[model samples]
Target: MPDKKLQLDIRIIKFQDLIGRKPDKPFGYYGLGVQYMLSGKPNMADKLFTQALNIKPGYMPAILGKLEVLLAEKKLVSAARLYQKNRDLFSGKKIYKTRVQRITGSLYSGKFFYYYLKSIRSVFVFNETIGALQRMFNADRGNPVVNLLLAMFFLKEHKENERAFILYNLCVNMEGVPDKLRWDLVKVLAKDNPDILIDEKTAALFTTIPEGAVGEPYANFILKQFILLKDTDKINQAFAEFQKNHSFPDPKTMWQYIEFCRENDIWDSTVFACCQKLIDYGWIDRTIAETIVGLKNRKIIEYTRGMDKILSLYGYI
Candidate 1:
C-alpha cells in the first residue's frame, strides 16, 4: 500500500499541477486564480478568475475568487452580489452549510469593521463607531471572531480576566488559526491568570520546535511575547527556543519590551538584561534610569502612605 502521508502530498501536488495545463480547464483556472490572488498578483489573479467563470458560469470558487479581488479593489456592491451568488449555488451539503454559517458569522463580525471604517470618515462620529462595535459584540455571542475581537476590546478597556477567559477557550477550540495567533492568546491568558495552572505537556507544544522543524514567524513572536509573561522556568525554556530560531532583538523593540515589563510590574533579570543593552547603546540615559526607579519607589511610598492614613483614622497609627 502507498504511504498515506506521501499519497496525500502527491494528491495536493497533482491538484497544484492541474491549474495551468493547456486549453485551461475550469478547475485548473480556478485553482491558479486563487493562488495568484493570495500571492498579491491581482491583475493575473483577475484574468484567471474571469477565465474560470467564462469556462463554467456559476462556478462557486470562480465567483468567490473574483469577489475577493473585487473587495480588495473596493467594489463592495459587486463583491456582495458575488458573495450571495456563492451562497445560492450551494446544494445543502454539510460543507456548504458550514461555509454559509461561517460567512454569515463573519458578516456579523464585519459590522465592527464597518463602524471602525466609518470612524476614519469623520472625527465627530468616532464615539458612535465604538458604540456600534460594543453593541454588535454584545448581540453576537457564538461567533469566535467576535469573541476574540471583544477580548481585544476588553484589553483596551482594562477588563483583564474577561479578555483572558474568552481567549483561553478560543485557543482550545479554534481551527484554521495561525500558530502565531494561538501563541498570543496564551500570552494574554498567562498574564491574567498567573496562578491558574495549565497542562505542562500541552504548554510544552509552544516552547520548542520539534527536531528538524521550522516555525511560522508569528509563532516565534507569540512564544517570545509569552515568554515575556511566564514564570522563570517557562520563561527560560521559551527563551532558549526563541534564541535558537530568531535573531537578536532590535534596540528599539527591546526598550519597548522593557517599558511594557515596567508598566505591568513584570520586571526580572531578562528585563534588566534588555535594559542594560539599551544603556550600552546610549538609548537610555542615567536620568531616565533614575526616573524609572523613582516611579516604582513612588508607587510603593504612596501605598504605604495610604495604609498609614487608614491606620490613623482607625486609632492604630
Candidate 2:
C-alpha cells in the first residue's frame, strides 16, 4: 500500500469520483470538503462546504466544517462575527455558547486573546490583556478557555511558572475538552523540559486528548505525553485516530513518533510501519530525521537499538 499521504490522495480522488457519480448527496461533498480542509485548501473546502449546504440545508457537519474553514482563513478575527451570526445555531453547545458570549464578545482589536492565540504576538498592551483574561476567569472559572488563556498569558510572560502550571493542570483535567485547547505555547515550553507541563507519574491519570482535530499540534502533544508515560497503547490509539481522520499526523508528528519510540525503548509494528513512511514530505524529509537525531539524548538501550533497527529496516540507515 502507498503511505498515508498517498492513501489520502487516493481517497481524495475516490471522494471526488463519488461526488461526480452522485452530485445530489451531501455526504460525498462534506467528506471531500473535510479532505480539502485537512490538505490546507480552505478556499476549496469552504466552496465544497457551501455546496454541501446547498444540497442539504442545515447540515450540522457542513455547518461545523464551514466554520472550521472560516476560523482557519480568518483565524480569530471572524470568530466573533461567525458566532454572532450563528448564535442560535450554537446556542445548544454550552461551552462554545458561553465562549462566544464571554471572550469573543469582548475581543480587543479584532482578536480574542483567549480564542485567537496567534494575536498574542501583536499584543503590546500587556496589562489590558491580563485584566481582560483575569476578568474572564473570574466570571466563569469552569470555562477551560478562560483558564487556558490565563495559562497562556503566564506561559507567554514566562514570569509566573508556578501559576502557569496551576492553570495548565486545570485545562488538562477539566470536565471535558470544551474548547479546543491549543497547546502551541505549552509545546514550546515542553520542548526543553517535557516534564514541565506533564510528567510520567501523572500522565496516566490525566484526561485523554479530546477527539476533534487531526494533524494538529495539540494532538501531537497529547500523543507525546503518552509516549513520555511509555504507554504504547494510548500512543497507538492516538495515531489510530489520526489514521481514521484519513489525514493522520503531520510529518513533524511522524518524526516525533520515531524519536519517542527511541526515547521510550519500545518498538512495535506501529514503529515499523511509521519507519516505512519516512519519505519526503516537501517541507520535511522524514527519512533523515535529518538523520538518527543527536547522540546525547538517547534514553534507553532498547530505544537506541530499536531506532537503528527501524531506520535500517526501512533502508534509512
Candidate 3:
C-alpha cells in the first residue's frame, strides 16, 4: 500500500489535473481547494476558493471553505463579515445559527473566548470551550442543542461519562428532540446502566432502530442486556420478534446468546435451534458446533475442554 504522504500527493496531483482541464468549473476549483486545505496550504486553498466564488458567486461549499481558512488564520473579523454576508445560506439551521451566534457573541463579550471557540474545530482545545459552555448551561439549562453539543464534547473529548449522561438525559427529555438523537442518548445511557434499556420510557426508542447497519448497535445492546439479566423470556421474545422482521442476530449477539444458554443450563430446543442457525450462517465453525453439542448433552467436562477455543472465537479472550 502507498504511504499516507504518497496518497496525499497522488490526490493533490489528481485534483490539480482536474482543475487545469476544467478551469471554469466551480466544483473543480472547490475540489482542488479542498485538496490544498488538506495539504496544509491554506493560502493556496484560499486562492482557489476565491476563484470558485468568482466563477459562481454564493457557492455554499466554497464560501464555507474560505470561511474555514479565515477562521484557521485567526482572521475573526473577516470570517464574521463573510458569515454576515452569507447568513441567509445558513438560515433555518438551528445548529449553525447557534454556533455563529456563540462565536459573534463571544467576539463582543470576550475576545479570549471568541478566539477559543473560533479555533475549536481546528485546534480542539476543549478547556476554554467547556468553561464557556458551562456558563451557557448555567444561564439556559433547558437549551437542548447546547446540552447535546456539550454532552458530546464531554463524552468524546473528556471521558466525563456522568456529566455526559446528565446532559444526554436532559436533552432527550426536552420536547421536539429528534428520535435519532434520543436513540443515541439511550445507547450511551444503556452502556453505563443497562437496566435502562428495559425501562418503559425507552421502549419506543428501541423500536426506532430499523433493520440493517443502523440497527446493529441497538440490537446487540438489547440482546446483551437480556443475556446479562438472565431474562430467558425476554430473550426468546426478542428473538422471535427479530425473526418475524427477518432480522438475524449479529455474530456478537449470537455469541452472547450461546454463552447465556450454557450458563443458565438451558439445554432445550431453543439452544439447539440457535446453534443450528449460527452454524448455518457461518457465524460459528465446526469446533464451536461440537462444543454446543457437548453442552446440549450435559457433558460438562467435554464442553469445558473446548471453552477456551469457543471464547477466543467469540473474542471474549
Candidate 4:
C-alpha cells in the first residue's frame, strides 16, 4: 500500500483530472483545483480553478482558490486584482463584504497564518503580512482583532520579544474579543515568550484601563501574577480552574501544557504526552516527534520511557 501522503497526492491528481474534462459543475472544478493545490501541483490547480471561474463567473471557492495560488506564488498584486474583481459579485454586497471580513477577520487570522506559513515558503510574504498588520495597527489602534493578529504575526516571524508582549497584552485587554481568543493569546505568550515576562508596571497599566477599553488592562496583571508567584503548580492549577469554570479550553490550552513540560526540563513525559495528544488528534508526525524527543534531557528520557508503558496500557499509542 502507498504511504498516506503519496495516496493523498494520487487522489488529488485524480480529482483534478476528472473535473478538468467535465467543466460542468463549478464545485467539482473548485474542489479538484484545491486538491491539486494541496498536492503541490499549483500550475495545474490554477488552470482548473480558472476553468471553474469561467464556467461560473461569480463562483467563490474557485476565485478564492485562484487568489490563494497567486498569493502562494508571491504574486500579491495579481491576487489583489483577483480579489477586487470578485469583490462586487455577491448581492447586497453583504455576502461579499462578509466573505472579505471573514478572510481578513481577527478570529480567522490565526488559522490563516498557520496555513499561510504552510502553503508559502517565502519569508518575504511572512514579513509582508507582519508589515500589513503593523500598518493596520497604526491606523486602527483600538481594533482588538488587529492587535491580536499583529501579535500572532510577530510570534510567527520571531520579532523582538517586547513587540510580542505589547501585542499580546493588547489582545488580552481588548474588549469584545471573544474570551476564547484572549485565552489563546495568553497560552501563546506564556509558552513562546516566557523570557519576556510581564512586570508590575505593565500589570498596573492594565488594571487602570476601563472595561470598554479596546484592549483591557488585566493582561499585564495576569502576567505579573505568573512572574511574581513563579509557581508552575499554581499556574497549572489555575489554568485547570479557568478551564473548568469558563468555556471549553481551546487548542492553545493543549499547547500550553506541552510547552510547560518543555520549559521545566520535563522532556520525556512532555514528548510522550504531546505525542499521545497528537496521535489522538490524528496529527502524528514521526520526524517532528523524533526531533523533540532527541532534544530532551536524560531525566526526561527516563520519565518518558515510563510514560511510554502507561500510554501503551491505555492503548493511546
Candidate 5:
C-alpha cells in the first residue's frame, strides 16, 4: 500500500478531477477545499472556497472553510470582516454572535489580540486573559468552546495542566462537544509530564475517550499508561481498539509498541507479527527486529495476526 501522504495526494487529485467536471457544484468545491486545507495548502483552499462561494453565495460550509483559512493565516482583519459580512447567517445564534464580536474586537492593526495577549500575559497582564475567560466561563459554564478556550489558556499561559485537564474533562462530558476539542484535550494531556498523568482519574479519562476521537499517537500514550500500571487487560483492549482504527503506525509509535512488548515480556505471536509488519513497513528498529527474531527462534509461533481475528476477538467480525 502507498504511504499515507501519497494516498492523500491521490485523493486530493481525485477531488480536483471531480470538481473540474462539476464546476457549478458548491459541495464539490467545498470538498476539494477541505482536502486542500487538510493537506496544508491553505492558499488553494481559500481560492476553492471562494470559488464555491461564487458558485453558491451564502454557502455556509464554504463560508466557514474560508473563515478557517483566514484565521489560520492570521488574517484577522479579513476573518473579522468576513464574519461581519455574514452576520445575517449567525445573528440568530447567541454563541456565534458573541464569537463574532470577540473576533471583531480582538483585531488590532492586522493581528489578533490573542497574539499580543499571549506575549504580555506573563509580564504586564498576569491575569488579564484568565480573568476575562473566567468571566466568560461563569456566564456559560456548559459551553464546550468557551471551556476549551479557557482550558487552552490555562495550559499554555499558566502551565496549569491539572486545571486544563479538569476543564477538558468537563468539556468532554458536555453536550455538543466538538471532535476537535476531544482530540485537543488528549494532545494537551500527552504533552504534559507522564508522571503527572499516571493517576487513576487520568487513566480513566484516557480509557473513556470518545470513540474515533483518540488519534493514533494519543492511543499510544494511553497504551503506555496501561503498560505502566501493568494492566494487561486494558493494554490489550486499547491495542485492539487502536489497531481497529489505525492500520499503519508511525515509526515512533511503532517503536513505543515494541518497547511496551519488551518491558512486559509479551512474546506472543501477535506481538511478533506486529513487529514483522513494522519491519515490512520499514518502521521497525534494529533492536525490535532482533528481539522478534529471538522470540521466533525460541519456539514455533502461530500465525494468528490479521484484522479478522482482531475484529472477532473484539466481537466486531
Candidate 6:
C-alpha cells in the first residue's frame, strides 16, 4: 500500500499548483478541499470548499464536498442546516438528489458517513470524525464491512485475535495488514484458527515477501488449506502442485531452512533444492560459503543427514 501521509502531501501539492495556475476556476479549489478532508483537516478543507463554491455557486461537486467536510468535522447541526438550505438544489438533478440523500443519512447515523468516506477511498479519521469504529461495530454488529474495519483498526493497534479471522471476512484492506502483523495473523490462522477457512483475500497476503527477509515467514502456508482434505496423499499432491508457483522466501539462514524442514517433517530432496535455490537466487545478504558454515546449531542441524553432506562440502563440521 502507498504511504497515506505522503500520498496526501503529493495531492495537496498538485492541487496547489492547479490553484496557482487557475485561481478563478472552482475545480482547483474543489480538488484541494478534497485532499485536505482526507488528511483529517476539516477546517482547511471547508475553506477551500467555500472558495470553490464562491467561484461557482451552482457547482454540485463543491456543494457536496463542503457537506462532506461538515460531516467530517461532526458539525451535524451545521451540516443539517446547510443540507436543508440546499434541499432544492439536490432535487434539481437525479444524481444530485442521490448524493443529498446519502449526506442526509449521515445526519442521523455515523455509519452513513463511514460508508461515505470509505466509498471515496480517502483518508478518514472515523474515530475522530464520526466516533470510534468500535462504536460503529457495536451498533451494526452484522455489517461485514464494519466488522472488517474494526479488525483492521485492531491490527493497527497491535491487537491480534481469532475473532477477526472468524468474521465473515471479505478482502481486508491492504493498509491494515501491516508487514509486522502479517506473520502473526498468518500463524494465528494456520496454527490456532484451523476452523477458519482461508479466504482468497487473506491468502493473497502471503505473497507479499519483503526483500532480504531473514526468515521463511511464508514457507508452508500454501498447503495449509489442503490439511482439510484429511488424507495425507491428497495433501501431498496439493503440496506438489503448490510448489509449482511458490518458493521459500523466509529461512533467511541455513539453520532456519533446516528448522523449517524439521518442523514440517519434510526431509527430502525438494527441501535441499529449495535451500540451493535460496543461495542461487542471490537474495540473501551473505555469500553461500558463509551461509553454509554460518552459526552451527547441532540440534537443528541433526534434522537431516543431507545437512552433513552439504556442510562437509564447505569444510564445516
Could you tell me how far off, in angstroms, the CA of residue 72 lies in candidate 6 after the best superposition? 11
Sort order, lDDT high to low: 3, 5, 2, 4, 6, 1
For lDDT, candidate 3 versus 6, the one ahead is 3
lDDT of each: 0.51, 0.58, 0.62, 0.54, 0.60, 0.53
Give the alpha carbon lDDT tens digit for every residue of 78-166 in model 4.
Answer: 55445545545522355554343333333333366566667766888767766665776666554433565566556556664776777
Judged by TM-score relative to the true structure, which candidate is superior, 5 or 6?
A: 5
lDDT of 5 by residue, 1-317 (tens): 99878977887888889888988799888888888888889999999899999999988778778877875675533564565567677555666644433332223223334675555637535465456556656765544334545664454454545656677556443333333334455556556545534444444444433356447454555566666676777767666765676653445655666677777777776576566676566553455645655575667354435533433454433
Model 3 TM-score? 0.40
As a whole number from 0 to 100, the lDDT of residue 209 in candidate 3 is 40
TM-score for all predictions?
Answer: 0.37, 0.41, 0.40, 0.37, 0.41, 0.35
TM-score of 6: 0.35
* Model 1, residue 240: C-alpha shift (Å): 8.5
Off by over 4 Å in 1: 1-25, 42-136, 148-168, 171-173, 194-197, 200-317
Name the candidate, 3 or 6, with the larger TM-score value.
3
Show where candidate 2 strays beyond 4 Å.
54-58, 70-74, 80-150, 159-169, 175-202, 205-232, 235-317
TM-score of 5: 0.41
lDDT of 2 by residue, 1-317 (tens): 68878877987999999999999999899999988877889999889889999999877667767666755654432433354456566666665544433332222223344544455565564555566656656655654435644664565456446656656666543332332343333454465556745443333432455456455555666666676676777777777777677755656667777777666665555554454455434332443442344331342122546556555566545
Residue pairs clashing, model 1: none
- Judged by whole-model lDDT over C-alpha atoms, candidate 6 comes out at 0.53
Best by lDDT: 3
Q: Which stretches of candidate 5 lie over 4 Å from their true place?
A: 1-9, 53-71, 74-139, 158-169, 172-317
Deviation in Å, model 2, residue 151 alpha carbon:
3.2
